[model samples]
Target: MGSLLLLTRIGGRPAAFRAEDIGSIVELTEIAPVPRAPDFVAGLTGLRSRALTVIDSRKALALPGTPDPPDVRAPVVEVGGHAYALLVDRVDDVVAAEGEPTPPPATLGPAWARVACGMIETAAGPAVLIDVAALVAGPHRAAA
Candidate 1:
Protein backbone atom coordinates (compact mmCIF):
# COMPACT_ATOMS: atom_id res chain seq x y z
CA MET A 1 0.00 0.00 0.00
CA GLY A 2 1.07 3.57 -0.67
CA SER A 3 0.84 4.96 2.83
CA LEU A 4 0.20 8.58 3.61
CA LEU A 5 1.99 9.90 6.68
CA LEU A 6 1.07 12.73 9.01
CA LEU A 7 4.34 14.19 10.18
CA THR A 8 4.50 15.52 13.72
CA ARG A 9 6.90 16.56 16.43
CA ILE A 10 6.92 14.53 19.61
CA GLY A 11 9.50 15.33 22.28
CA GLY A 12 11.05 17.71 19.75
CA ARG A 13 11.85 14.81 17.47
CA PRO A 14 10.32 14.17 14.07
CA ALA A 15 7.67 11.47 14.04
CA ALA A 16 4.90 10.22 11.78
CA PHE A 17 1.62 8.42 12.07
CA ARG A 18 -0.23 6.77 9.27
CA ALA A 19 -2.82 9.21 7.97
CA GLU A 20 -5.47 6.50 7.99
CA ASP A 21 -5.05 6.06 11.74
CA ILE A 22 -6.20 9.58 12.57
CA GLY A 23 -9.85 10.41 13.01
CA SER A 24 -9.37 14.18 12.99
CA ILE A 25 -7.10 16.89 14.27
CA VAL A 26 -8.51 18.97 17.08
CA GLU A 27 -7.46 21.97 19.15
CA LEU A 28 -8.23 21.17 22.76
CA THR A 29 -9.37 24.13 24.80
CA GLU A 30 -10.10 22.25 28.03
CA ILE A 31 -9.14 19.01 29.70
CA ALA A 32 -10.40 17.63 32.98
CA PRO A 33 -7.80 15.63 34.81
CA VAL A 34 -8.57 12.00 35.49
CA PRO A 35 -7.72 10.83 38.98
CA ARG A 36 -5.53 7.70 39.42
CA ALA A 37 -4.98 7.55 35.70
CA PRO A 38 -1.53 6.76 34.35
CA ASP A 39 0.91 9.63 34.17
CA PHE A 40 0.75 9.55 30.41
CA VAL A 41 -2.96 10.33 30.34
CA ALA A 42 -3.36 14.07 30.10
CA GLY A 43 -7.00 13.85 31.14
CA LEU A 44 -10.23 13.93 29.17
CA THR A 45 -11.72 16.38 26.73
CA GLY A 46 -14.96 16.50 24.81
CA LEU A 47 -14.95 16.43 21.06
CA ARG A 48 -18.18 16.90 19.14
CA SER A 49 -20.06 15.62 22.17
CA ARG A 50 -17.78 12.60 22.54
CA ALA A 51 -15.20 12.32 25.26
CA LEU A 52 -11.61 11.74 24.27
CA THR A 53 -8.86 10.59 26.62
CA VAL A 54 -5.97 12.84 25.83
CA ILE A 55 -2.58 11.16 25.75
CA ASP A 56 0.61 13.16 26.10
CA SER A 57 2.79 11.65 23.39
CA ARG A 58 5.97 12.84 25.00
CA LYS A 59 5.07 11.17 28.25
CA ALA A 60 3.83 8.13 26.41
CA LEU A 61 7.23 7.90 24.77
CA ALA A 62 8.83 8.07 28.22
CA LEU A 63 10.56 11.30 27.32
CA PRO A 64 11.86 13.68 29.92
CA GLY A 65 10.31 16.90 31.22
CA THR A 66 6.69 17.94 31.51
CA PRO A 67 4.37 17.39 28.56
CA ASP A 68 3.06 20.18 26.42
CA PRO A 69 0.23 22.02 28.10
CA PRO A 70 -3.40 21.51 27.24
CA ASP A 71 -5.06 23.81 24.66
CA VAL A 72 -2.58 22.24 22.30
CA ARG A 73 -3.46 20.51 19.03
CA ALA A 74 -3.86 16.75 18.89
CA PRO A 75 -4.65 13.99 16.47
CA VAL A 76 -7.80 12.12 17.31
CA VAL A 77 -7.66 8.36 16.96
CA GLU A 78 -9.68 5.37 18.06
CA VAL A 79 -7.79 2.51 19.57
CA GLY A 80 -9.72 -0.64 20.57
CA GLY A 81 -12.99 1.30 20.35
CA HIS A 82 -11.82 3.97 22.79
CA ALA A 83 -11.28 7.45 21.45
CA TYR A 84 -8.09 9.33 22.24
CA ALA A 85 -6.54 12.67 21.36
CA LEU A 86 -2.77 12.26 21.20
CA LEU A 87 -0.98 15.40 22.26
CA VAL A 88 1.88 16.27 19.97
CA ASP A 89 4.37 19.10 20.15
CA ARG A 90 3.60 20.12 16.58
CA VAL A 91 1.35 18.83 13.85
CA ASP A 92 3.09 19.08 10.53
CA ASP A 93 2.11 18.32 6.92
CA VAL A 94 0.95 15.09 5.38
CA VAL A 95 3.30 13.61 2.84
CA ALA A 96 3.20 10.63 0.54
CA ALA A 97 5.34 7.69 1.66
CA GLU A 98 8.16 7.19 -0.82
CA GLY A 99 8.14 3.50 0.02
CA GLU A 100 6.86 1.02 2.54
CA PRO A 101 7.91 1.51 6.12
CA THR A 102 11.10 -0.33 6.97
CA PRO A 103 12.78 -1.37 10.20
CA PRO A 104 13.99 1.52 12.31
CA PRO A 105 17.72 1.98 12.55
CA ALA A 106 19.71 0.50 15.40
CA THR A 107 20.47 3.97 16.69
CA LEU A 108 16.77 4.46 17.45
CA GLY A 109 16.28 4.98 21.16
CA PRO A 110 14.26 2.68 23.42
CA ALA A 111 11.48 5.18 23.88
CA TRP A 112 10.76 5.64 20.18
CA ALA A 113 11.56 2.05 19.26
CA ARG A 114 8.92 0.86 21.66
CA VAL A 115 6.15 2.34 19.51
CA ALA A 116 7.78 2.54 16.12
CA CYS A 117 6.12 0.44 13.47
CA GLY A 118 8.88 1.31 11.08
CA MET A 119 10.75 4.12 9.45
CA ILE A 120 9.47 5.66 6.22
CA GLU A 121 10.87 8.13 3.78
CA THR A 122 9.18 11.45 3.16
CA ALA A 123 10.10 14.60 1.28
CA ALA A 124 11.32 16.15 4.49
CA GLY A 125 13.32 13.13 5.68
CA PRO A 126 12.97 9.72 7.30
CA ALA A 127 10.56 9.67 10.21
CA VAL A 128 9.69 6.85 12.56
CA LEU A 129 6.13 5.73 11.92
CA ILE A 130 4.42 5.65 15.28
CA ASP A 131 2.16 2.78 16.18
CA VAL A 132 -0.96 4.48 17.50
CA ALA A 133 -2.20 1.41 19.33
CA ALA A 134 1.08 0.91 21.08
CA LEU A 135 1.35 4.62 21.82
CA VAL A 136 -2.06 4.78 23.45
CA ALA A 137 -1.24 1.58 25.28
CA GLY A 138 1.43 3.53 27.12
CA PRO A 139 5.23 3.47 26.97
CA HIS A 140 5.65 0.07 28.55
CA ARG A 141 4.68 -1.96 25.54
CA ALA A 142 7.37 -4.37 24.43
CA ALA A 143 9.47 -3.28 21.49
CA ALA A 144 8.87 -5.11 18.24
Candidate 2:
Protein backbone atom coordinates (compact mmCIF):
# COMPACT_ATOMS: atom_id res chain seq x y z
CA MET A 1 0.00 0.00 0.00
CA GLY A 2 1.18 3.52 -0.77
CA SER A 3 1.23 6.20 1.95
CA LEU A 4 0.86 9.93 1.40
CA LEU A 5 3.38 12.34 2.87
CA LEU A 6 3.40 16.07 3.31
CA LEU A 7 6.78 17.52 2.37
CA THR A 8 8.02 20.55 4.27
CA ARG A 9 11.17 22.56 4.88
CA ILE A 10 12.24 23.14 8.45
CA GLY A 11 15.26 25.35 8.97
CA GLY A 12 15.91 24.87 5.26
CA ARG A 13 16.27 21.13 5.73
CA PRO A 14 13.86 18.75 4.03
CA ALA A 15 11.33 16.94 6.20
CA ALA A 16 8.14 14.97 5.71
CA PHE A 17 5.07 14.25 7.79
CA ARG A 18 2.54 11.56 7.17
CA ALA A 19 -0.50 13.09 5.49
CA GLU A 20 -2.75 11.61 8.15
CA ASP A 21 -0.84 13.43 10.86
CA ILE A 22 -1.66 16.84 9.47
CA GLY A 23 -4.99 18.46 10.23
CA SER A 24 -4.62 21.51 8.01
CA ILE A 25 -2.09 23.82 6.40
CA VAL A 26 -2.57 27.41 7.44
CA GLU A 27 -0.94 30.77 6.88
CA LEU A 28 0.17 32.14 10.27
CA THR A 29 -0.62 35.82 10.43
CA GLU A 30 -0.62 36.45 14.16
CA ILE A 31 1.11 34.67 17.03
CA ALA A 32 0.68 35.68 20.66
CA PRO A 33 3.78 35.05 22.69
CA VAL A 34 3.45 32.72 25.64
CA PRO A 35 5.62 33.86 28.49
CA ARG A 36 7.86 31.38 30.28
CA ALA A 37 7.21 28.79 27.63
CA PRO A 38 10.00 26.63 26.27
CA ASP A 39 12.22 28.12 23.60
CA PHE A 40 10.88 25.67 21.08
CA VAL A 41 7.39 27.01 21.60
CA ALA A 42 6.97 29.80 19.05
CA GLY A 43 3.70 31.13 20.50
CA LEU A 44 0.00 30.59 20.22
CA THR A 45 -2.52 31.29 17.52
CA GLY A 46 -6.21 30.77 16.98
CA LEU A 47 -7.49 28.10 14.63
CA ARG A 48 -11.22 28.40 14.21
CA SER A 49 -12.37 28.86 17.81
CA ARG A 50 -9.60 26.79 19.35
CA ALA A 51 -6.22 28.02 20.48
CA LEU A 52 -3.28 26.46 18.68
CA THR A 53 0.14 26.31 20.23
CA VAL A 54 2.85 26.81 17.65
CA ILE A 55 6.11 24.94 17.83
CA ASP A 56 9.16 26.17 16.04
CA SER A 57 10.14 23.39 13.66
CA ARG A 58 13.67 24.73 13.47
CA LYS A 59 14.09 24.59 17.21
CA ALA A 60 12.33 21.26 17.49
CA LEU A 61 14.84 19.86 14.99
CA ALA A 62 17.64 21.25 17.17
CA LEU A 63 18.52 23.92 14.65
CA PRO A 64 20.24 27.06 15.88
CA GLY A 65 18.91 30.54 16.57
CA THR A 66 15.45 32.09 16.56
CA PRO A 67 13.37 31.80 13.43
CA ASP A 68 12.59 34.92 11.46
CA PRO A 69 9.24 36.70 11.35
CA PRO A 70 6.13 34.66 10.58
CA ASP A 71 6.34 35.05 6.83
CA VAL A 72 5.77 31.37 6.13
CA ARG A 73 3.04 28.83 6.74
CA ALA A 74 2.37 26.13 9.33
CA PRO A 75 0.78 22.71 9.50
CA VAL A 76 -1.75 22.15 12.24
CA VAL A 77 -1.59 18.79 13.95
CA GLU A 78 -3.15 17.20 17.01
CA VAL A 79 -1.14 15.67 19.79
CA GLY A 80 -2.42 14.29 23.07
CA GLY A 81 -5.83 15.77 22.30
CA HIS A 82 -4.38 19.25 21.88
CA ALA A 83 -3.72 21.08 18.64
CA TYR A 84 -0.31 22.39 17.60
CA ALA A 85 0.84 24.53 14.76
CA LEU A 86 4.22 23.61 13.38
CA LEU A 87 6.15 26.60 12.14
CA VAL A 88 8.17 25.62 9.15
CA ASP A 89 10.28 27.58 6.71
CA ARG A 90 8.07 26.42 3.87
CA VAL A 91 5.50 23.81 2.99
CA ASP A 92 6.66 21.86 -0.02
CA ASP A 93 4.31 19.32 -1.60
CA VAL A 94 2.48 16.16 -0.75
CA VAL A 95 3.83 13.01 -2.39
CA ALA A 96 3.36 9.29 -2.21
CA ALA A 97 5.82 7.54 0.10
CA GLU A 98 7.43 4.69 -1.80
CA GLY A 99 9.79 1.86 -0.97
CA GLU A 100 10.81 0.60 2.44
CA PRO A 101 11.54 2.87 5.35
CA THR A 102 15.21 3.36 6.04
CA PRO A 103 16.71 4.14 9.42
CA PRO A 104 17.33 7.78 10.05
CA PRO A 105 20.86 8.78 9.18
CA ALA A 106 23.36 8.74 12.02
CA THR A 107 24.29 12.24 10.99
CA LEU A 108 20.84 13.47 12.08
CA GLY A 109 22.22 13.28 15.62
CA PRO A 110 20.43 12.06 18.73
CA ALA A 111 18.01 14.96 19.06
CA TRP A 112 16.58 14.67 15.57
CA ALA A 113 16.71 10.90 15.59
CA ARG A 114 14.43 10.81 18.59
CA VAL A 115 11.62 12.58 16.75
CA ALA A 116 12.08 11.16 13.28
CA CYS A 117 10.39 7.87 12.53
CA GLY A 118 12.72 7.09 9.61
CA MET A 119 13.85 8.33 6.23
CA ILE A 120 12.25 7.86 2.85
CA GLU A 121 13.36 8.59 -0.69
CA THR A 122 11.23 11.00 -2.65
CA ALA A 123 11.24 12.71 -6.03
CA ALA A 124 12.95 15.69 -4.43
CA GLY A 125 15.39 13.60 -2.42
CA PRO A 126 15.53 11.81 0.91
CA ALA A 127 13.44 13.43 3.63
CA VAL A 128 13.44 12.83 7.34
CA LEU A 129 10.06 11.51 8.40
CA ILE A 130 8.83 13.38 11.43
CA ASP A 131 6.90 11.54 14.09
CA VAL A 132 4.52 14.26 15.18
CA ALA A 133 3.44 12.58 18.38
CA ALA A 134 6.98 12.06 19.50
CA LEU A 135 7.91 15.58 18.50
CA VAL A 136 5.01 17.07 20.42
CA ALA A 137 5.52 14.82 23.41
CA GLY A 138 9.13 15.87 23.85
CA PRO A 139 8.56 19.31 25.31
CA HIS A 140 5.56 18.48 27.45
CA ARG A 141 7.30 15.44 28.83
CA ALA A 142 10.42 17.42 29.59
CA ALA A 143 8.44 19.97 31.53
CA ALA A 144 7.10 17.37 33.93
Model 1's number of clashes is: 0
TM-score of 1: 0.91
For the record, the alpha-carbon RMSD of candidate 1 to the native fold, in angstroms, is 3.2
lDDT of each: 0.88, 0.83
Residue 122 shift from truth in candidate 2, angstroms? 1.3
Clashes of each: 0, 0
List RMSD in Å for every model shown. Answer: 3.2, 2.4
TM-score, per-candidate, Cα-based: 0.91, 0.89
Error of 1 at 109 (Å): 1.8
Error of 2 at 94 (Å): 0.6
Instruction: Give the range where candidate 2 is weakest over 10 consecutive residues by summed lDDT.
Output: 135-144
Runs of candidate 1 with Cα error greater than 4 angstroms are 66-71, 141-144
- The digit string of per-residue lDDT tens for model 1 on 19-119 reads 99999999988989999998999999999899999998889988887535532778999999999999888898988889988998878888888899999
Looking at model 1, report the run of 10 residues with the lowest lDDT sum. Answer: 64-73
- Among residues 3 or more apart in sequence or in different chains, the pairs in candidate 2 whose N, CA or C atoms overlap within 3 Å are none
